[model samples]
Target: MKRFLLLACLSGLLSLGCAAQPAATNVPEAIRVEVTGKKNGRPLLLVPGYVAPGEVWREIAAELGRRYQCHVVTLAGTGGMAPLTVAPGASYYATYARALAAYVQQHHLQKPVLVAHQTGGMMALRAATDFPELFGGLILLEALPAPFAVHNPRLTPDSLKLPAREQLLSRLVSMAQGTFLQQQQMFISTWATDTLQQRRLLGWAAQADRTTWANIVYESMTTDLRPALPRLQVPVLLLGIWVAGKAVKPDLTHAQVQPLFERQLAGAGAGGEVRLHDTAREFIMLDDPRWTLTNIEQYLAAHPSKR
Candidate 1:
């Protein structure tokens, strides 16, 4: 009888141990934002490019957070946010922007400087144009103009048809299911210019869901921000990667891309300004966070509050 009692006690203990184990955390169903840095410092909002979650900005956020209030927002259907029930596309951009604007309003953030990358840059441009009162200035890293186009023979924009969306989604799922090394190699090949950036980006890319990844690329290729660029009312910064005399073909050169951006800025009539950085590309914050942060800090210092 004692043996039976001991066995039962052991079983109960095992069950208790099992129950104490922590369950996995569920990703949020909507947008998720993380705020860090000085509570009293000027507000600096970090906006990541399409498909990338707020994790991509960790390095920059960590550094910037020390001196400025940093708000890193992961759009709906990506990062820690829950996947969307609606088709993930350009409309998602508008939805995310509105949500972002609301977050700022709810928190009562002052006119914050928006720091954006790639497709995030496009979204920033849209937000700044549409909701000028919400922002103080704009910084675009590795920015592509509205009607963003890449002349690569290997890549073509997905068709507008619904079938194309399914095809793209399937490809993304397959890529996500690949071995870690395979996924890392794919990201490095596509975005990272050097080994260090490649390593960092690989980590960021791994955290994203396959569907979000596909949606970002599809939205980036199809959405045209050209019409809205000229309407932005804030100062702008354009940071780009400099590739000089490399045998390798770049997705787009600074010379080829800068003029397009400049033209759009001139037309926007917002009195927006553009500054070029040859040292970095689309992921400037990752490539050189210190430099990027310093530039942003200095720019904000020079531009007093318009609000």
Candidate 2:
């Protein structure tokens, strides 16, 4: 009876998972779910990072879709999509996880592989952990089970000091509430490029809801998923950037970050592997789409799923 009720609840949410597209050429450039690729191929879902649109997966999706059906998801409050309606003090990540899982069910996807970036990666991990049978595999790019834990595995959610978490949340909120120029500047510094086109793209990210962004960022930093990692039944692939050529302060070298990657893979049960790229930054898809596509194909081959 309990399982029946849960399925019923999920069925309702699936109805609102995505908006219908018109036959005419009036489809929204930015949407929740944009399907493309081979019509008779395996299903794969691409989830973009926080404050990023599904368009970020354009190049890779186009390539990967040639052999696989790609379902690109643009999270709400970013990329001109409507924000999820919620009351005060709601967990946006929880809402996103449900919406993503529903999207898979709604599309009748049979064990789709989930490829996610940053915060999307974290949400995908949560979804996979909760509903392991729904997915074939998972590929997380530069995601963290918990920021504090990645930096130091000795720290758990309970061991994390509240004052430090509060300060981090406060800073993230301030960044989210900053002006377009301020936000653009922040993006430029992190990405280390300020071309005219890049600035224009940053405009979309600048419009994200401050409250929603802050909530998810706070959750990703504070919520430790190490305990739930062992629950994952599907194959997991984690990719991290070395940033060897980039000029930055207190640069995170591969040697330093490799340990964190090892810890994550260790906690992710038996079906997981980690790969650290030499030159990619946060945006691995954009930095090296070929490498990303190749690795994904290899991983999918290793863990074949039936539809």
Would you estimate the TM-scores of all the predictions? 0.75, 0.80
Q: How many angstroms is residue 266 displaced in model 1 relative to the true structure, after the best TM-score fit?
A: 3.1
Kindly report which residue stretches of model 1 are placed more than 4 angstroms away from their true locations once superposed.
1-28, 87-90, 147-163, 174-176, 179-190, 193-197, 244-257, 279-281
* Per-candidate clashes, comma-separated: 4, 0
What is the C-alpha lDDT profile of model 1 across 117-164, one tens digit per residue? 776777777667667667788887765544333333222345333336
**Error of model 2, residue 66, in angstroms:** 0.5
Say which candidate scores most in lDDT: 2
The residue-by-residue lDDT of candidate 2 on 133-216, one tens digit each, is 688889987776665566577877677544343454355455433442453454353442336435645665566665566566
lDDT (CA) per prediction: 0.61, 0.68
Find the candidate with the highest TM-score and give its number: 2
TM-score of 2: 0.80
TM-score between candidate 1 and the true structure: 0.75
